[model samples]
Target: MQIAKVRGTVVSTQKDPSLRGTKLLLLQLLDEEGHTLPEYEVAADSVGAGVDEWVLISRSGHAACRVQGNEDRPLDAVVVAIIDTIYLEKRQIYNKREQYR
Candidate 1:
């Protein structure tokens, strides 16, 4: 798993049949300090993560397919959780409540 930020939504009218109705999100990978990295990914949203939210991402296609309803879909990544807080070196770096407010 990896940490990333949901940067935006990805809309596709034409895609594999198994992918229909799945919410796709554009994610920017985050560094250990919570800063955005240059790498970007499009992931199936299994956790209903919204834009700007820090999320836990499963980057394995096999793991993504194991998520409920994502079975057999050609997914390379999936949003598995919406992060509520992040602490590093005893310092709080992110708090969802405070960040959204």
Candidate 2:
């Protein structure tokens, strides 16, 4: 799993049947310092994360496929949770309440 920020949404008019109802999101991976990385990925949204929100992602296809209703979906990543807060070394690095306020 990795921390990421939802950058945007991905829309595909034509896609595999298994992905028909899945919500795809564009995400930029975040470093330990909460800085965005150059790498980007499109991941299925299982937790309904919104753009600009910090999220937890499962990058393993096997783990992503384990999400309910995505059993056999062709997905390499998936948003597992919408992050509420992050703490490192006893110091708070991110707080969703403060970020949105």
Of the candidates shown, which would achieve the greatest lDDT relative to the real structure? 2
TM-score of each: 0.95, 0.96
lDDT of 2 by residue, 24-100 (tens): 99999999879989988899997889889999999998998899999989899999999999999999999999999
Name the runs in model 1 displaced over 4 angstroms.
none
Candidate 1 residue pairs that clash: none
Model 1 lDDT per residue over 1-101, tens place: 88899999889898899999999999999987898899999999977888899999989989998999988899999999999999999999899999989
Superposition TM-score, candidate 2 onto the true structure: 0.96
State which candidate has the highest TM-score: 2
